[model samples]
Every structure is written in C-alpha cells, then in structure tokens.
Target: MDHPSPPRKAPTLCSLRTGLALLLHFCNVALLSQRVCLSLTMVAMVNRSEPRGAPNASLAAPLDNVKNPVYNWSPQTQGIILSAIMYGMPLIHIPMGYLAGICPVKKVVGSALLLSSLLSLCTPLAAEAGESLVIACRFFQGLSQGTVQVAQHMVWIKWAPPLERNRLTSVSLSGTLLGPSVALLVTGFVSQSLGWPMVFYIFGAGGCALSLLWFVLFYDDPEEHPCISLHEKDLLRSSLAEQVSSGGKSVPVTAMLTSLPVWAISLSGFAFSWTNTIAFLYMPTFISSKLHIEMRENGLLSALPHLLSWVLSILAGHAADFFLARKILRLVTIRKLFTTLGLLPPALLAVSVLHPSVSPLSSVVGLTLASATAGFCMAGLMINPLDIAPRYYGFLKGVTVLIAMVGGLISSTLTGIMLNQDPDSWFKIFLLMAAINVTSILFYLIFAKADVQDWAKEWQGTRL
Candidate 1:
C-alpha cells in the first residue's frame, strides 16, 4: 500500500538570525532618531520664548556663553538645514540596490551606519563653524543612511520564509517608531543637562559600536552564518529553493520601475511617509507652543504618541501573520484591509484634532489615537516589497523609499514656511496632511495586491 508522507512541520521563529536582524534595525533607527532631535533641540534653544511677543525671535541666536556655542541661523536657514538630509536622501536610493547586490548586505548597512555615526560626532563642530557646514554635514548624514533600508531588504531576501515574512519585516521595521520615541525622551534630558552637543555624541557612539557588532555576527547568506544550526540552515535553504537563486543576474531595472505593483506600493508609501514626517519634524514644536509645554516636557509628550504607535505596530504585525497563517482571508484582501484600517481612521480622526474648540488634553488624546492606528500600515504597504519579489527585495525597497523621500522633502520644507512660530495656524497643516493620507489610501486600494508578481523570476536566463 502506498502511504502519503506526513506534512512537514512549520519552522520555529526562535532563530539567531531573527534576533540579529531585529537588533541591527533597532540600532539604526536609534541613530535616525537622534539626528531628528538635533533640529528640534536647536529650535528650543534658539527660539527661547520669542514667540511670547519677543522681537525677531524666529531669527535670533543666543550670544556666546557657557553652553555649547550657538548659531543664530534664520528661519529660512533652519528650514534648509532640516531639509538638507532629505535632499541627499532621495539621490542615493536608486544606487543603493546595486551596491547591496554586489556587496554583503551587512557590509553595506554596517559601513553606512558607521559613516553616519562619525558624521553625527562631527555635527557640533561643524555647526559652530557656520550654517553651510551644518547643512553639509546633515546632508551627508542622510546620504550615508540612505543605503540602510535597501541593505536591510537585501538581508531579509536571503533570510525570511513565507509564513514568517510579515512578523519578521514588521518587527524589524518597528524602529521607525521607537527611534523617534527614544530620541524625544532621551535627547531632551541629555541636551538639557550635558549640553546640546552630547545629544549627537551619545547617540552616534552606538551606531559606530553596532556596525562592528554587525560585522562579527551577521552573514549575507544562510549557508554562510557561523552561528546557525544545521537544521535551521537546511530549513532555510529548502524554504528558499523556489523564491531565491544563488546564481541570479541583476534585477531588471525597466521591469521593476514600470511594474504596476512597485508603483502602487511606492505611491502609497509616499503618503504614509508624508504623514509620518509630520510627527517626526513638528510634533515637539506643536506640543510645546500650543500646550504651554517646556522643551523637555514636550519631548516626553511628543514621545507618547510614538510609544503607542510602536505597540500597535507590533500587535498589527502579529495579527497579520495570524490571519495569513490560518487562511482566514486572502493575502491581498488582508493587505488592502489593513491599509484601510490604518490610513482611514487616522485621517478621519485627525480632522477633529484640529478643531479650535478642542482643549490641549483632548487634542493630545486625539493625536495619540490617530498615530497609534496609523501603525497598521506597517503590516500592509511596508512588507509588500518582500512579498512580491523576495529575490529583488532590495531594489524594490529602494524604489519605494526613494518615492517616500520626495514626500518627506516636500512636507518638511512646507511646514517650515507655514509655521513661523504660531500654534493657531497649525490646524491647517494637520488638515492638509489628513487629506493627503486619505487620498493615498484610496489609490492604494485600487491597485495594491499581495501575490508575488510573475515578473519576479523573469531575470533567470536573461542577460545581465
């Protein structure tokens, strides 16, 4: 009698690779968070109650004194300094995939962070020199980190299996939220007591340290890791047999950029990022100027929304994996639904937050809920790159991140022009953000899908 073999057991998630990936992501996010704080901290130190009817407060700089030397860059100069990072960010994404393809992903990601950390260490010295140096250093910081996303995707391509993809990607990316939260909470105290320069020095030190740790522990291929057990490695190889190829040619650039799936993911990511950069760049200022909160207190208050956002993102990732694993819904349906759940409610709630009649406490609550719910997109658009093209995930990530960086540039610069120090005018900015979020979700619903595209494997026999 012929008997069917028993079904293979699903692999466990308690692998060393998962932990290493998570930690690398967490540390990189922390580096990003610290750079974000420099601008907000400067705003606090330089503005110094000027909006409380002080003369030319927006353009004033403190005279040389005991605290770290000051630069009185104008509002226009400050705007340029903040946007400098995004200017360099968008230019590097397209090239990053090629770098990741040629080099070990850990080398690419770790080296980039090391450079960013070194740049962060030099920021105070550059700032004291003049505005131009500050802008130049900030731009290069963004340049160094631009490759991080693409490199991480390259690592995930060789590491994650289908059943574990959602949880793995979301957990790794949760640093997007945690980075800013930690930055806001800690930077305030570090700068307040130790001086503003320590903010960069303390944060940059971790990035430099982690790059060396990453080199020691991480390997680009499952077969290459010194620490992985034989059984787990075999499972990984077997799981990846069809999805990835060891002798693959470069990703087809025209095929990638022209693909509908890529554009859908990229466009939606633009909207998601537009809303997010608002929180990163402006939330502290809003909390401080509007609610009568001080800078350190404002950092704490600003951090609350991000902390809740982080928790919700993790829960959302787990729930997404659960739904997909049980086959309770189609993967495509689940992704679109998650997008709606994340972007729609946040947009609807954000409008109410801007109402003049709302009290500061009520406004804070409203913003928190909106931000927390926005975390669901982490499980949706963010992970779709690996879903559609495991072999070329790095390239796809570059495309999407580059698209989103354009939105970051626009939102950051526009907010600077729109808010000259007045809290009352901020409601209009919130509404504009809500409208963009709503529109982006609508477009995503029409085009987004979760299945691996046929073109994903089309490069197998083609010329390089």
Candidate 2:
C-alpha cells in the first residue's frame, strides 16, 4: 500500500531556467518600451513645426512662379536639383558600406542622419542665394542620404532575425514608394500656400529631430542595449548565431568586387533599375502627353501604380517565405520563378502602350500591371544578399546599388535623347526599357543562385 502512493513530480531544470529567463526579459523589454515611447513623442513634437504662412494662405504665387524670373529656373533645372539626391546616392554608398563593416551600425547611421539634416538645412539658404548653391547643397544631401541608406540596411541585418528579415526590409524599402505618396499629397499644398523654402526647412528640421532620437534609442545589437533583459538578449543572440558563425570576417573591397555572385546580382540589379526608373520617372510625362491628363491628375494617377506595387511586394515576400518553409522549391527556383514572371509583364505592357488603337484607360491599366508585377522580382533579387551573406548584407547592397545607379543614369540620358529626337515617340523609349527588363530575367535564370556559394563557404571556414 505504501509503495502504491503517488510519486511527487519534480521541477525540471529547463522549466525553471525558462521562467527565470522570461521574467528578466520582460523587465528589460519594459525599460526599452519606455525609452522608445519617449523618443517617438519627442520626434512628434519636432514634426509639428508650422509652415511660414498661415495654414489657409494662398500657395498660388509660389505655385505659379515655380518656373519664374525670381528663380529663373526651368522645370528641367528643378528636376536636376531634386534628382541630384538620387543620382549622387550610388557613388557614396560603396565606401559607406565598407565603413559600416568596420564601425558600429548605430554610430554610422546616426552620424549619417546628423550630416544629412545639416546638409538639408543648407538647401533653403542655398536656394535663396542662387541655383548653383542649391545644386551644391543637393549634391551633399545625396551623399548623406546614400550613407544613411547603407547604414540602415546594416542595422536591419544586425537586429532582425532571418525569418523576419524580408518583412523588416520591406518596411525600409517601402519608404521609396511611400515618400512620394506623402509628397504628392502634401508638398503641392505646402508649396502652394507656404513657399518653396518651407519644404526644405520642414524636411531638414524633421531629419535633425529624427537624428536625435536615433542616437538616444538605437542599439547596434540587442546585447548592447542597456535596457534589454538578459533572457530576450539570449534569444536574439541564439537566433542569429548561425548566420554570424557562417559569415567570414570582412574581405578587402577588391575581393568583394571580384565575387562572381556579387557581380551577377549587381548586373541583375542594373537591368531592374533601368526598367523601374523608366517606369517611375517617365511614365507620368508619357501619360500626360499621350493621354491628355492634367499635371495634378497625372501625379495622382502615377501614384496608383506604386500603391499596387507596394501591395504586391508584401504578397510576394509572404509567398516566397511560404514555399521556402514547406521545402517545396529551392531558393533558386523561387527567385527565378518570381523574377521572370515579374519581368515579363513590363515588356508585355510596353507593347500594349505602342498600339495606336489602345484606349488611354487600357494603357494606364497596362502600365499599372507592369509596375505591380515588377515588385515581385524585388522579393527575390532584392533579398538575395540577405540570403547569401547576412553579415555582409550592407556591403553587397551598396555594390548592387552602385551598379543600379549606372543603369539609372543611362536610362535618364536615353530618355532625354529620345525625347529630344521626338517627344511624341515616348513609346520607343519604353520599348527599350522593356527590352532591358526582359534581359534581366534571362540573366537571373542563367546565373543567380539562391543558396550560399563556394566563396562564402571558403570564407566562413577560414574565419572559423
């Protein structure tokens, strides 16, 4: 009867440890939450700066005179200044990437924001002084912006888990689409009522405020954050341990440049960039001329395609992850399938635009479909760096971006030449861009790989 008594259960070591770890983790997360909340509130206050004129004041004077004698600037001149930020970005991104490899991401990111804010502050003053000063200010702004982009990608790699990488990367990249949405919605109203100078002032001040918050709140790694609980920190560390272990110490810039995979990805990005920039930068102009849409309507309509693009990007990323998790397809197959499908639509849509009998609505729909489809390619090609070398994601992104920049330059020049030759022949330029998009698919199908390559394995072994 005594032997039949129920045995008492013992507390397992793993259970006890997990409980203690969770308790510590929560405490640390609470502290971090408070800091982030405070930082966000401060940023909100900075963003509340009022425009120069009363809210209801007429913006027509500034709007009407955007190309007037006071500035004596053509639309082309203003475009050059606005685009300078984008153009100069690729040039500095490479060096900035190397710096990110050596320096703490938080410092690199924070410093770049600080510098960008400072440069942005100079823009209003420059414009008031002369067009030359404006160009100079924009050039510096481009450099700083490029540095920020590189550093931001580095931060994401350092902080986010492998599984969550695409989602988080989308958040950052979405800014490319979202920034224009904000500008189109607000900038016209702001410039119309307040003045052109107010635009730069608001953006500059906002950047400065964000820089302050970034410095105070961001930690390069979870382990380095003062407020993170030991348990949560451990979780973060364990999740990324494999990736960290696999990534070799940083190689020389020349060696990185010579990497076959790197070159392949870069070349692919170049083709994608050419097609994408042509669609985004020139499509509205084409629409206005061909479809007889007003400037305001054109701006709004142009934004619709990118909205479709943003949605498709999320869906594609999720679908890619799903296939990857089920082991239904290799990463290479996943990339190839999506990228090829994405590229095909643009070419088809470009052909649609060439048809003289196509209705304007049909043409717009075709263009929208093309932009939306192209976004899926980003799910594969844009994310390849994170797949192959999580540690060197920033450096690789920089290299690809530099290559893409050349493509953008070529696209711009080609567009200008085509327009000069025959403004009515915009369809010809689109056809050329469509060819580039199609060629990108061929390159990816032939060369791009989803898995880590021999060089990476060799590098990892040497480092270990």
**Global fold similarity of model 1 (TM-score):** 0.91
Clash count (model 1, backbone only) = 0
lDDT of each: 0.75, 0.59
For residues 1-464, write the lDDT of model 2, one tens digit per residue. 12233222222123222232222222222211211111111111111223333321222345444421133343344345434555667889788766776777667766767676677667556655666776677667667767766666666555555555554455445555444434333333344456445545565666666666667767766766776666656655666667652233644455556676676677777877777666655665677668877545665666677667766766776677666656676787887787776678888787786788888888888888887676776577777877766556666778888887778767765675666467776777777777777777777778787676555544532211
- Sum up the clashes in candidate 2: 2
Best by TM-score: 1
Quote each prediction's TM-score: 0.91, 0.77
Evaluate residue 444 in candidate 2 and report its C-alpha lDDT on the 0 to 100 scale: 71
Which consecutive 10 residues in model 1 have the weakest lDDT in total?
Answer: 49-58
RMSD of each: 3.8, 10.6
Instruction: Name the regions of candidate 2 deviating beyond 4 angstroms.
Output: 1-83, 117-125, 193-197, 227-231, 245-259, 460-464
